[model samples]
Target: MRWHKRLLAAGAVAVVALTSAACGGGKVRGAEDSPQPGTSLSAADATFTYVPNLDVVTDWDPASSYSNEIIAMENVYESLTRYNPQTKKAEPRLATSWTSTPDGKSWTFTLRSGVKFHTGKPLDAAAAKAAIERTIEVNQGAAYIWGAVDKIEAKDATTLVFTLKYPTALDLVASAGYASYIYDTTATTDDLNKWFNAGHDAGSGPYTIDSWQKGQETELTLKKFDDYWGGWSGQHYSKIAFRVTPELTTAWQLLQRGEVSFVQRLNSQLFAQASTTPSVQTSQTPSFQNLLALFNTQSGPLKDVRLRQAVQKAIDYDGLIAAIKGSGVAASGLVPGGLLGNTPGMTPKQDLPGAEALLKEAGYGPGGKQLDLTMTYAQGDSDQDLFVTLLTSALDKLNVKLTAKPLQWTTQWDQGKSKDESKRQDIFIMYWYPDYADAYSWFVNVFHSAEPISFNLSYLKDDAIDKEIDSLPELTAIDQPGAEKAYADLQNKIINEQAAVSALFVQNYQRAYAKSVEGYVDNPAYPNVVFVYDLKPGA
Candidate 1:
C-alpha cells in the first residue's frame, strides 16, 4: 500500500494534539507507561486498539469471506489450528494436537480436555466435526480449502478424524486464517453465516465482541475464559478498541493526540515526521506485498496480447517510484522478490520502439485508431493515484488516451468482479499480500483458472500453465531441486508470455507507537502478527 507522505506530515502536529485529548493526559513516564514488565496477562486482561482504513467491513463471515476485518476478528475468534509467528508453524488452538497418516491423506486431532465455547457450551469432538463440515456444506466459495475433505468423523468426545481425497500443503495454512475458524453449531446456521458475512462478529478467541458500530468503531472486552485450554497468566490490557479512519491524515492525527497508542499504514511523509516525534517511535517489517496493474482483457483493446505487451513495455517503473519517493524496489514478477520462486532482476525496460512496433502489428498506429482506456483504483489511496498518474503520463507519450476513475474500495471491488464485461473498467491497479510464505499461496489463488475467486482479473489462461501448477505437489514430494526447477520454469513461462505486468518494489510494513509502548517487533514470516499479549507499558 502506497501512502502519500506529504499529506501525513502536514497533519502530524494536529494529530498529536488530538491524541493527547483522547488519552486524557494519561502519560506514561519514560517507558514506565508500558504494561507491567515481564508479567504477561491471561485471556482476561489483554487488550489494545487497531485502526483500520475501511469504514464498513464487507465480509466478516469466516467461511465464505475475505478481508482485513477478518484479521482483527481473529483476536476474538479461535480456529482449530493457529499459526505460530515465532515457529512459522501451525499449532493447536482449539485442538490440542493432530497427527497425519503415513500416506498424508488422512488426519486426526484431539481436543483439549474440558474446553468450553464462549456461550459456555462444551466443545467436544462432535462439535468440532460439525463446524468443519459446515464450512464446506454452506460456504462453497471456500471449497478450495476444505472441499478436498472426503470425510470427518467424531471418535468419541475428544477425538476428530479427517480423511482427504488428495494431499495438500494448504491444509495447515488454510486452517490458520478465517477460512477455518470454528463456530458454534447450536446457533442458527443463518445467524452464524450472517455474522461471518456482515460486519457482525462472534468468535471463541481471547476477546469477545463488546460493541461494533459499522464504519466507525469496534470495541472488545477480554473475557475470563477459565475453561480456555491455553493456560492464562496475568495479562496486560483489559479492553481493545478498533477504530476506522479511512483518511490517513485522520489516523496520523489520532496517533499524535494519543487517541491511539499506535498507528500503521504509514507512508514516507508520516514515517519521517513520526521518527522525529519525541513521544513516538517508528519501525517497519518486510512484507510479502506486490504492486501491479491488472488489464481487462475481455472487452478492452487490451484483448490483443501485443497491445497488452506494448502497454506493459510503456510503464516507467523507476519514474513511478520517484513519484512515491520511498524505499521500495522495482518489481518484475507477480511474486515480489525474496519469495521462494521470485524471478530475479528488474522488469524489462520500457521499449518504446518495441511497443510502437507491437501496436502497429496489432493494427493500431499513430493514425490508425485511438483506443479509449479507463483505469480504476481505490479512492483516498494516494499511492494508487501516484501509480495511475505516472502510467497515464507514460501512455500519453505512446499516443494512447487514458481516463482515470477513482472509486471507494468496496465499490471498486464489487465492480471489478461484475459479470457484465462492459461495466468493468479497462484497467485496475492493485496489490496482493500473501497469507503465508508460499509460492502456491500467491500464484495459484491469483492465476489458477480453476480458482472460483481467481485474482487473475485479466482472465488469462493456459493449459500448460494449469498442468504445471497442478503437478507442483508431486514434483515437490519427489525432490526439492525438482520443485525449484518447476517453479523457475513457471516464472519463465509467465514472463515469456507477458501473462501480467508488474514493477517489483521493496516489501515493507511500517508501524509507529508512543514511546511508552513496548514489546512490538515486526515478524518476518507474517508481518501483521503482533500478539496483543506481547505489548506492555514502556519505561
Candidate 2:
C-alpha cells in the first residue's frame, strides 16, 4: 500500500490559485502612512533592529513554542538543517549530510565536523541524539512532528540515525524548522523546563543571547563562529536587537522613526500605508500560513454535517475580501491555492439557497433553531477582526446567532491545542503555514484523523480519511499524478462530507530595507521560514 494508494483507499483530494505577489492590477499598501528616507549604517558599526510581535512566549521549548516571538530565539539557536529559500530544500546547518534507506523507514545524518554551542561545548552525535529524544519526551504538543521516529541512535561521534516506525514522506522537511533544532544535551529536562518557564533560550546559531528584559526587549550579539561551515566572510553585522511591540501602530511609528529595520505581520491597511514610504520597500512571499475557521464538531449543533455545510455555504468570500481591502484571495478548498494538489479557479459554493436547505434539513432553518456560535481571533489582529465581522454578517442572514470573541494571542493558541478536550474553544479562526511545499503537510498531518494536532478542528475522525492521509508517502513515491489523483479524491470527499471549510489562503507580506538588505530573495522551499544569514547589504 503506497502512500497515494493509501490516500485513495482512505480517500483524499486538490484546487489551485494564482501565486502573484500583487493582487489584481493595483499598488498594494505599505507598513507606514508615509515614506521615510532610508537611513545609513556604516559597515564598521553593523547592527540590525527588528520588532517582533511580542516578548518570547514564556514557553521557550521548540515543541511548545509556536509563536512568532520564538523566531528571535531560533536565530540564536540553529536547527540541524535550514530550509534554502532559493531551492525550497533543506540544506545542512548543524548536520553536514544525511541519507535515508530506500524503504524510508531509517535515516542517518553526519554531524558537522567542528561545531560548538554558545557555552563552548562541542556538538556531537551523542548530543544531537539527546536533543532529539528530549524534545519528543518532553513536549507532547510536538509529537505530531516527531511521532514517526521509532528511535534515535548515536552511531558514532559524528553520525546519528533515526529509525521510523512508519514510512513518512515529510520526515526530512518536517524536521527542518523548529522540530529539528539541536539543543545542549548537558542540560537536564528540568533545566530545559526552567529555561522555557523563564523565557530563556540556548542554541548554537550565528547570534548569542545577551539580555532579555521581559516584555520590553531582547538583545543579542554575533558570536563570530570562526569555524561556521556557512562561512562568515564579508558579513557586516556584529549584533542584532529585537524589541517587543505588541501594538501595530506603535511598531509602525518606530519603523518610521527608524527605530527598527524590520517589522512583521502587518495588516492590509497598515501595509497599504507602508507602501508609500520611500524608506521601506515591501515584499511578499507565499507564507506557510493559512487563516481558517476551526469548527468544533464534538460539541454544539455544528456536529451535524448539514449544519457545517450550511455555515460553509453562508460565507461571502468576495465580501470578506472587500472588507480586508488588501491582498486576500477567496479560498475555495481546504488546501491553500498556488501549492501542489490545488486546481486553480475553483470557486467556493456561495449558494444561500443551498445553505438554507442544508440548515433546514438539519432542523435549524429560519425560525426553527437559533444557532449561538462563538468565533475567536487574535486580540490585536485587525485583519482577523475584519474577517470575523464579515463572517458574522454573512451567518446572520440565515438567522444564526454568532458571537465574536477576541482572545489574547497566546491564550487562544494554547486553548486551541488543549489536550483536556473538554476545555477547547467551540470555534476559532487559525492559520497553517506549510512546513514544506508538499501537499501532505496541509492534508495528511493537519486533517488526518490520527494526527493528535490534526488541524481538523472539526474533530472529524473518519477511518477512511485516516487511511488516505496515512497512504501519502507510498502514493507520492510511486507516481506523482497518481498521488495527486488520490489526494483529489480525498478532497472531494471532504467537500461532499463537509469536513472543513476554506476561508482564504493568507498572503505573506515582508518589509525590509530595500536591496540594502542583500541575500533577501524569497525562498521557494517553505515560504514561512526566512534565513537571516542569507540577507546582507546588496552590492
Candidate 3:
C-alpha cells in the first residue's frame, strides 16, 4: 500500500491492492508451522489448484497488498470475521462472537481460545490490537477501511474492544474486510517490508504459500490447522497453485490439457464451448460488477456536460455486447443490478444523431469543432479491441477523433488512479466491483471529492449531490428504507447527469471448473468469483 491514504479511493478495476516500494532483507517470518491440535485431515484432502484470470501479486502483507487478486495472501491470512456468501453478512471466524453498543460507537469481541498462528503464537487480543495498530501506522490503502477506529484495547488474551469515532455497521461488513485479519505479532520485525514482501506471510488459515515463481505461478500447499477454532471448508487439498494465465482461451486450454484443475472465468465467446467440453462444468452467477469508461471530470474537454452526453450517445451499448459476445445484462446506472443504488430501466441506447446533435451543440460538429480524445481499456479483456473498434467507428461518424490504446490491466489501473490529473485517463475502462456490501463503497469512494484525489477519476464536487451522499450514514441508520432511497437517488443523479463515467453493462459472471471440483462457491467480494477454500470432491 502507499505510505499515506486519504480514505478508500476508487481502484481502477475491481481489484483491491496495497502498493509499496522497497524489497527488504529477511526470510519471511512465521514460516514455521507448529503441529495444529485438532486437525485430523491429511494433506492430500487439502490439495487444490487452478489458473487465475489475471497475473499480478503486488504485496503479500494484508496491510499493504492491493492487487485485484490476493488469493495468495488472503488465503493464508484469516480475518476476525469472514463474509458469509449465503447470508451476505459478516460471520465470526477468528472471534467466537462480538457485540456493539446501542449507538454503534464501540464494539467488543470475544476471541476464540486455543487458536494459534503458523509460528505457534496464540491468537489473542494483543495480536489483534497490534495488527490493527500496525496497519494504521503503515497506512496501506486498506488502513482507511478501518478509519473509524479511534482506539483499540486489549482487555485480556481473548477479549478485544474497539472504540470508534463514528457509529458504524462495520462489524457486519468491515470486520470481515481487508486489514482486519489477525497477524502473529510475535513474529513482527522492524523491517516488516522485508518480512511480508519476501514471499512470507502470517495467518491461521488452512493453507500456506509453499512456493511462488513470479510470472509463473504461486503454489500453496496446505494441512489442516487442528488448533483452528473456526469452521473449516473446502476439499482437503494438500496443495493449490495459482498459475498466471491472463487470457481466457489459455485458461480453457489449460483445463483441456489437464494442466489445471479449474478456470475461474470463461470469456463470453467460449461460454458455449465450455458446455460441451468433456470433464468440465460451468456455473453462471450474476455479477455485481459493471464495466465503465471513466472521465477525468475534474478538468479536460470532458468538463462540458454536452460533450459527456455526446460521448454517451455515440456508443452502441448493444453492439458492444454483441461484439464481445458478453453474457450479462446491459447496465442501467453507475451501480450494477442487485445492489441498492441500481436503477434498472435506464440502460442506454444508441443515438448517433442525438450524439451528433449534442456534439454540434457543444460546438464540435464537422468543421464546427473536432474534439480529439484518448481512450484506454485493459488488454486481455475478451473482445476489448472489438468494442474499441465499434466505438471508434461511431466517433469517426461524429467527426470526433479518438486514439484508442490497449494497456496491460495493471498499467491502465495505475493510470486510472493516478494522483496527477495530467497523468490520469481522459477515459479509461475497468470493472467496478462492490468493495463492501453497500453503495457507499461505489458512489462515495469513486465520486466524493473528500477522498484521495487519485480515486475521484471524475474530479467532481457538487453541493447538491454531496448533501444526498452525505446523508447515507443517517439513512443507513434507518436500515433498508434509507439505504434504498439514498442509493437509488444517487444512482439516478449519476445516470441522468452523465456523471463521471460512461456506464456500460453488468455481465453474468461465469466460471468453468473440472467436473471433479464440487464445492466451488461464488462470492461477490472476489469479483472474478470463487473462493479457494470451498472446493472439495463432489458426491
- By TM-score, the best candidate is 3
Q: Which digits, one per residue and each the tens of the lDDT, describe model 3 over residues 152-206?
A: 9999999999898777665654543456667876566557666776566578776
Q: How accurate is candidate 3 locally (lDDT)?
A: 0.66
Q: List, residue by residue over 1-539, the lDDT tens digit for candidate 2.
A: 00211111111110112121221111222334112334433324455666665443334565444434345555666766766545546677777788888877788888888777655678888987887787777654334566678898999999988888766653354444445668776644566655443434446777655444333343222233444445688764655556556677777777766656667557676778788887666776655455677677766667777777887778777777677765556665555655556655455746789988888887776877877777666665666777778777777888888887787644565566677876676666766555445667666655667445435566767788788877776666445687777778777777656546454545454554432455555553433233566557443
| lDDT, candidate 1, at 22 | 14
TM-score pick, better of 2 and 3: 3
Candidate 2: C-alpha lDDT:
0.60
For all candidates, the clash counts are 39, 40, 25
**RMSD in angstroms between candidate 3 and the native structure over all alpha carbons:** 5.8
User: Over the stretch 1-539, how does candidate 1's per-residue lDDT look in tens digits?
Assistant: 11111112112111111010111012212223333323332323334655555432334555654444453556656667766545656677778788877666677888777766665677788887777777677654334566457898998998888877765443464454445777666644466755444333345665554444332343222333344555466445545556556677777776777666567677779888888988777886656666657776656687777887788777777777676666355665656655556666536566778877887787775665666788777666666777778778777776788898886554565576777777777777666665545566555655556433336666657778778877665454335577677777876666547545444354566787766677777654343444555566544
Ranking by TM-score: 3, 1, 2
> lDDT per model, in order?
0.59, 0.60, 0.66
Cα deviation at 273, candidate 1, in Å, is: 1.1
